[model samples]
Target: MSDEARVVRIVPNGPVMVQGPVRIEMPDGTVVESDRFMCAICTCRRSKIYPLCDTSHRRRQRAKDDESSTTVTVQAPAEA
Candidate 1:
């Protein structure tokens, strides 16, 4: 690895772009590592693969008059 500093970019309403290879430690004390040139870290927690961006933050398309257009809100569980 070069002595150069790694870059981290925050995308608006999206994932955080990180220059890899990187190692991440989860709340459960598990360690995750990536050797890619770049990594997309999830910020919305909507990713099926936690800590990795799967583009799940992107909004789904719906017709203006679609009955399913009704929005449902969910609250995150309170931290202990």
Candidate 2:
């Protein structure tokens, strides 16, 4: 558990991917394991992984698509 190393990278349209040894401290004073051999941090904030990314964004994206089906009502601009 020594050899502590941290890797932080930003993934497009997704969460960050962290590699190497990492320690994530929760507000509850609980330190979660951020390295599952490698960690994929959620940037979309929609990851079911909680503190990691399990590719759950796919489902989130699908839900987003479904939401897009609803038409957005825009009010006309007031006459200047």
Candidate 3:
């Protein structure tokens, strides 16, 4: 623990996990520190908490499986 090494992990389609103490400086010079052993940093920019990951990256569940898999490629109308 004396070494104080910090580790970061990029979760697939998810947050960036940071281990150990970390200080995050915002755009306006506001500093946020993590008290937990690990913290999730938002990557999708959808978090209400800005830099923190509130699991906003998760995809919404479709009612039907076909609805989830369907990809509708729309064609533009021909110019008159």
lDDT of candidate 1 over 1-80, digit per residue (tens): 67998899999999899987667777665566666688788899987666776677889834435423222222343456
Task: Tell me the tens digit of each residue's lDDT in model 3 across 1-80.
Answer: 56876788999999899873566777665666665577778899987566776676778633444223322232333446
Per-residue CA lDDT of model 2 for 1-80, tens digit only, reads: 54865667887777787773456655655555543555676666676445655566664345445433322222333446
lDDT of all predictions: 0.69, 0.56, 0.66
TM-score of each: 0.68, 0.54, 0.64
Candidate 1 structure lDDT: 0.69
lDDT of 3: 0.66
lDDT of 3 at 46: 87
Error of 2 at 25 (Å): 0.6
- Score candidate 3 by TM-score against the native: 0.64
Off by over 4 Å in 2: 1-6, 59-80
Q: How close is candidate 2 to the true structure, as a TM-score?
A: 0.54
